[model samples]
Target: MVALKSGLKIRKLAATLLLLGSSCIALELHTDPAVAVDPVDAVCSNRMTLSVTGNLKVPYCSNKILDQPDLSVQRAVIVIHGTSRNADDYYQYMEDAAKKAGKLDGTIILAPQFLREEDIESRNPGNDVLFWTNDGWKEGDSSLSTSSNPRPAQVSSYDVVNFMMAKLANRNVFPNLQTIVIAGHSAGGQFTNRFAAGSQEPIVESTVIPMRYIVANPSSYLYMDEKRRVAGTVDKFAIPTAQEKSNCPNYNEYKYGLEKLNSYMQNIGVNKIRSQYAQRQVVYLLGEQDTDPNADSLDKDCPAMLQGKQRFERGTIFYNYLQQYYGSTIQGNHTKVTVPGVAHSGRDMFNSDQGIQQIFGSSPNHHLNHPTQPTYPTSTSNS
Candidate 1:
C-alpha cells in the first residue's frame, strides 16, 4: 500500500461512502487471507462520513483502533485515501506502524472515503461504479464549469477533513488528545501536499498545535506558475510574469486560470479565512527506491512543470531551495528528510517515526502548539 500525493491525482470518485442521517448501521471489514493480520493491531475497519458542516458521524465499531483496553497512544491521527482509494489498506498499515512504534493507543485512525463521480450522492448512471458503495470507486471526471464546478464540488471531496478536524480539536472527542498527524503516500502524498499548501482550517490554526503534513513519493505537484508560459526554468524570473502565447496554448483551464486563482485568494480574504499555509510545517517523504518511467506522474503535471524536473528530484530540489532562499524564516521551522531503503510503497513512509518527528516532534521545550504565526512567502523548486 502506498500513500499518494494530490498533485499526482487523477479523476476522483463522486459519491458518499456512508449514508447520511442518523439511521446508518456500522460495518465490520476484515483482513484478506493474503495478508497476515498482526495480532496486536488486529481489528475490523469502521465507516465514517464527511459533511459540509463540522458534524461528522463516527461509527463505533469493534475495530482495534478504538478499543483501548490498554493505553499506549496520546494523540489522534487521521489517515486519508490515496489515488487508488484503498483507504482500508491505509488504515491497516497505519495501525501496524502505530503498534510497532508503541503508539497505537494514543492514536485514533480514521479513513475517510472520497468516491468517484458515480459515488457522489449516488448519482450512479447504470454501470458506472458507485464509489461510495462497497469500494473500488476509481476517480472520474464528474464536473465542468470553472467557478461552479472545480472550486466547491471538486474540492468538496476533501470536506471529510473538516469533519475529522472538528473531532480532534474538540477535547471532548479525544480527552487525552495531544497531537495530530495528516499523512499520505504517493498519490495520497500529493493530496497531503496540496491540502497543506491550500487548507485554511481554523481548528488547525487556533493552537500551537503542530498541523504537520507528511508527503511520501508523490508523482506530481501543482506548480505555482503552472500556466506553462514560463518555460525551461521559472525561479530566475520575477514573480507573477505574464503567460506568453507559446506555452499553455489554451491557458484558461489546462493551467489554473489566472482570474480563478485571483478569485480564490480574493474570496478567502473577503471571507476573512485564516491560513496556516504561510507557516504550516510540511515534510516531503520521498521513497529512496520508488520511481516510474511511464506514468502521468513525473511527467507533465502541475508539479512536473513546476519543478523543471522529475517527481522525487523536484521535491528534493524545492526543499533545498526553500532552505536556501527562505533560510531566515524557515529557521529551524521547516525540514525535508529522505526515507532509507524504501520504495514507492504506502506502508513505507506512513510508518516513518523519524519523518513524523520532523514535523511534529514533541519535547518539553517545543512550541508546535502556537497559532498561525505568519512567515513571509519564500520560493524554491527542484530543477
Candidate 2:
C-alpha cells in the first residue's frame, strides 16, 4: 500500500511538470523575438489643436509646448516619423539626439503623428481628430472623412506644419526662438522634401526665425523638372527617352516629378516653388551604407527606379541634379551629408556628429565643414 501511494505522488508530480513545460512553450511561441511589434499600436501622449480650415485635433509628441512661452528655448526641431506613424519613437530619438548634443536644455523636439484610417478605426482617438489614407499623408493629401468622423473641413497634412510654424513664429510665445529645423526620415523625408518646395507659408520667410529642412534617406525625391539621372552615369541627367517614357507613363507625376500638382502644391506656382526651395537651407542626409537594392521598404515602382537603383545612389544623384540645376544659387543654402557605415537608421543618422551639428550648430555654415567619417554598425531595418 505504501509503495502504491508513493507511485501515485510521483505520477502527479510528473503531470504537473509536463503542464508547466507546455505553458512555457506556448509563451515562447507568443513572444517570438523575430516578429516585430507594429509601431502604430502605440499612440502619442499629446494633442495639438490645429485651426486650419476649421478646428481639429492632431496627435504629436513634444518636449515643450508651443503655446507656452519658454525663455530658454532657442531652437525647435520637428522630426517627422516614418511610415509606421510612430511619432512617439521619433520624438524619443530626437530627444536622445538633443541630450547627446548637450542641447537638451534649450532645444524643443516635436514629432507629429500622421494617423491612417485603420489606426483611427482601431484606436478610436476621437471624431474630430485628423487622419489620412495610408499613403496620402506622405503626399500632403487631405484628411479623410467618414460617417463616424464627419469632417468640418478638409485639412492637408502640410497645413499642420504651416499652423505649427505660425505658432512658433509668434514672438509672444517663443521670444528667444532663433531657428526652426524640419527634419524627416523615410516617408517623412519625402514629405519634408515636397513640403520644402511647395509650402507657401509666409512665416517660413521670417528673417527673425529662419527655417531649415533636413531630408534623410527618403525613398524618392521630388524633382523640379522631368530630368532624371542617366543610367550608369554618376551625375549626368536627361529627360526620359521615348522608350523609357512609354514603359512608365506616370513617372513624372507630382510625388516623383512636377507633372500633376496636388491642391496644396497647386496653390504655389512651379517657378516660385523651385526658387523658394533653392533659397531654403536644406540638407540631404544620406547613409553611406544604405545602398541595398532589395530593401524591404524601398519604393520598387518605375518612377522611383528612374531616380536610382538604391537609396544611396538616388540621394547622390538628386544632390548632383540640384547642383546642376541651381548652380551657385544652391551652394550656400543646400548641402549633402553622407554618414559612413550607417544604413536606414534614423537614430544613427540623427545621433551622428554631423547630424548633431546640422541640428544644433550655431554657425549658419557649420554643416559645410564635413565631419570625419566614422564607422557605425549597419542597421537593416527601415527608418
Candidate topping lDDT: 2
Clashes of 1: 40
lDDT of each: 0.44, 0.76
What is the model-wide C-alpha lDDT for candidate 1? 0.44
Error of 1 at 173 (Å): 1.8
Q: What is the per-residue lDDT of model 2 for residues 1-383, given as tens digits with 9 covering 90 to 100?
A: 00011133565466557757797753553332112123265667677786544567888888888688999988989999888787877888899999998999998888888887667766777777888765678887777776766667667787777767767777777888778889998888898999888764342322466678899999999999988989899599899999999999999988898877776676677888888788777899999999998776788789999999989899999999998888856778888998988999988999988888887776352211111221111111111
Question: Model 2, poorest ten-residue lDDT window?
Answer: 374-383
lDDT of 1 by residue, 2-31 (tens): 222233122222112241222232111111
Of the candidates shown, which would achieve the greatest TM-score relative to the real structure? Answer: 2
The estimated TM-scores of all candidates read 0.61, 0.83
